[model samples]
Target chain A: MKAPGYIFAEALRNLIKKRATVLYPYREVEKIHLPDGFRGKIEFDRPKCIGCQMCFRVCPAKAIEIIEDERGKRPIFLIYRCIYCGQCAEVCPTKAITLGKVFENVALRKEELEVR
Target chain B: MSFEIPIGPQHPIHVEPLMLKLKVEGELIVDVDIDVSYIHRGIEKALELRSYPQGLFLAERICGICNCAHSLCYCLNIEQLLGKEAPPRAKYLRVIVEELSRVHSHLLWLGHYFHTLGFETLFMYFWRDRERVMDMLELMTGNRVTTSYNVIGGVRRDITPEIDSKLRRMIEHLRERMKYYEAAIRSEPSLLGRLQGVGLLKPEDAIRLGTVGPHLRASGVKHDVRLDDPYSGHEEIPFNVITYDTCDCYGRVMVRIGEVFESLDMIAYALDHLPSGEYRLKMPPFFKAPVGESLSRVEAPRGELIHYSISDGGTNPFRYRVRTPTLANLASVAAMLKSRGDYEVYIADVPAILGGIDPCICCTARVIITDEGKKTRRITTLTELERYARERGVRM
Candidate 1:
């Protein structure tokens, strides 16, 4: 019911427009600004942590584990298992654990994912 | 003589794993059997073992594309059990994100549908615009694909002014693009020829076979959960319900595209009238829900997604059930594919018919493990399924 030229013209118009594809890995891109409440990797502060195990109990993924050291008990985060829902960070009384904006946690070794 | 052509337990046409056994005489399909037992993660049973907060993650992961709907439905279900209502501001925010996800989901489906039909340019264009929606989701909820935004009480994050401005800009850009798309679809003779009068489903049959969402609407049945059962600030926001009476593949495509415009309008309204208050309530992490059961339904991108849960005064659910939209539409697919009387279906129309429902096979096929060697079927619980995988040293 319609002319064929119009369809081709419509398809060709996008060519003149700016490309929407992002140049990743090959080129340096613009910095991504995460919002204030962005839930990312769990960052635990050893000094502020009271070893109360609140983060451990509230964690959905069970990614946090508290271990006893000479000073006191400290938590280690298994990054791979963490769903990054920010429950641990929210439950932390002293704000020892927080969801940092560093979402690119890719590593070659499995041990690299474990953070203190 | 008729021949059986098995399309898939795996196929490139559909992104998800679905087995379609088609019985054909020449090029015409005579009969069809859809096997959706391949992808079962035991999510419902797994939900029964985890606590309420933990279960939210599992629920969201059920369907990657419609995670927002799953989490929202789960939150609404739990909130009903707790007898707690989210604040006004939170309700508006929920609507904003829910509609944004709907935009992204519909765009994704539209692109994929065209790609299946060999129109790669439109596919590329749709996906490119979809990225803008994904960026908005990442900006608002922190994650792109699976935005774990909805919590038990309300949304996880609040909307900031900066994000609001960006959202308005993106919506405006998409409006222009969608208009062009609408025009293109209307004029393209080849596209119309491929789609029109293919895979017909009558209105009575759609209701009889339990079709939901756009699939039902495509057949001239006016039904939508947002209209029927208003939830998450849907009552305040007004939008038109789109339906096409052609009852064919073209109608399905037209209905979805029309709904995208409707979603855009709703998102703009929600953003303009954004309320001020706490986005989430301070609920205890571990608390036993009172003995009761609640059913919650959300209009997912695919269709109506229902979540039912029973709590026996325990931290974990006693039983959890999920009825995905694709399961409801599968019977209708069988009816359409079968060659009866004047309706003749060819094997070439398989992609159009399957994609018409916008099938999410992963969500639909979450049960029934058959062992052909033993000639028996064993329904394994999540724990037992885990052990079975472990014994075989299989990484799922």
Candidate 2:
């Protein structure tokens, strides 16, 4: 059991410690050092692609679509539906798709989210 | 005559969409009716349409806070169906994240519960500390809230040394804060006045109503899925099941607080004793499961979350059922809220009672909007829904 003034003493101690609240936008926050193996937006290495369809098959979100354009059969990534689970990256036989560190893929248009 | 005091399909006390019809005679609550049909996403049906891997994602989304539990249960269910287990190291990793999530959840609840009881200072303090847990989660799983870390075979990624060190530091920080909180909660007269002996739930009543998790534990029932039915190497890890025999709202708070400490210890143990092996099994991307049925139960932060899946040699499950803890605990709410001759319950105690069980109505409820005036009841099929969506084009 604690006394009534326990909170005040704790608050007084916390006053000296660094504030937990981050002043974002108004102040330039220190850059966050992302750990390795972080799952972010998918980066497709088109040159390494053999069109194995492994990524297309394993994608749980159905975010990856194999588009047969004039440039040959290539997977078109719909970031709008992408969950960033990175199953596509894991299942990619040719190591084509990699989950990059850049997670901020927000945009005005959903079309802008799509990555070929 | 008893008047109805309807507390929302939308209310300030809780964030989720749930309606409570409290029959009151003056300030005393006479009866209670809960409507949990406001926010059903038909996620179970959607899970049936998707493959095993796809279902994992949907399962994780069942409850944002208990995503790890849902995903773990889903994986265990599928693994049982396929007749394989995740590697030992992976099991430890699962325990690590799952327990971390539990800490995050318990802290989140503690903060939210105090807030509901009008303790804004404690709320701010709890939430401020909660950010550290969230940071640990983000560091470990990559995403803070919806951690898509737990995959079917194993986890999505492995933990690095930096993450391990950071997590330990955070756990130490949290341990100190929890100790302070425990002391503060025990001695705080105002908090005790609001919580103690308010919204009493007897042991028999709790068991009868099938109340699982901390709520049941609060009523002095020594039952936890982790202890009773150990999943994902829980048996290998040593931890105590914390329970309080107060049989009231105060007991629930104590139970959760005790759990935070236990979860912290469990995470540390799992990290220290983590085995070195393949995290995930090599399974084909899309494969049909042999005809079988498997049920997996996880001790989620709230309570026992059970997932049952039946597969008939199909890519997708034949039937999938999710029994969230909140749904089970809701039955006891009505019993607790009723004002008996001696055991009285007031309107102001509504939040205290409701918040005690840590209600996650979104996980329990499903919405089916009916057009009564038109007199048309339509059950839209997946194909029809898909066609409608396609015709509308994709809107952001």
Clashes of each: 1, 2
Cα error, residue B378 of model 1, in Å, equals 10
TM-score, B chain alone, candidates in order:
0.94, 0.93
Residues B4-46 of candidate 2 have per-residue lDDT tens digits of: 9999989998688888999999998998988888886888888
* Fnat scores for every prediction: 0.54, 0.50
- List, residue by residue over B23-141, the lDDT tens digit for candidate 1: 99999999998888888788888999899988998899999999999999999999999999888889999898999999999999999999999988889889989989998999998
lDDT of 1 by residue, A28-67 (tens): 4554556666678877788898888988887778888889
Candidate 1 CAPRI-style tier: medium
Q: After superposition, how far is residue B188 of candidate 2 from its true place, in Å?
A: 1.1
lDDT score of residue B200 within candidate 2:
93
Q: In DockQ, how does model 2 score against the reference complex?
A: 0.50
By summed lDDT, which 10 consecutive residues of candidate 1 chain A come out lowest?
A: A24-33
lDDT of 1 at B177: 90
In model 2, the fraction of reference contacts reproduced equals 0.50
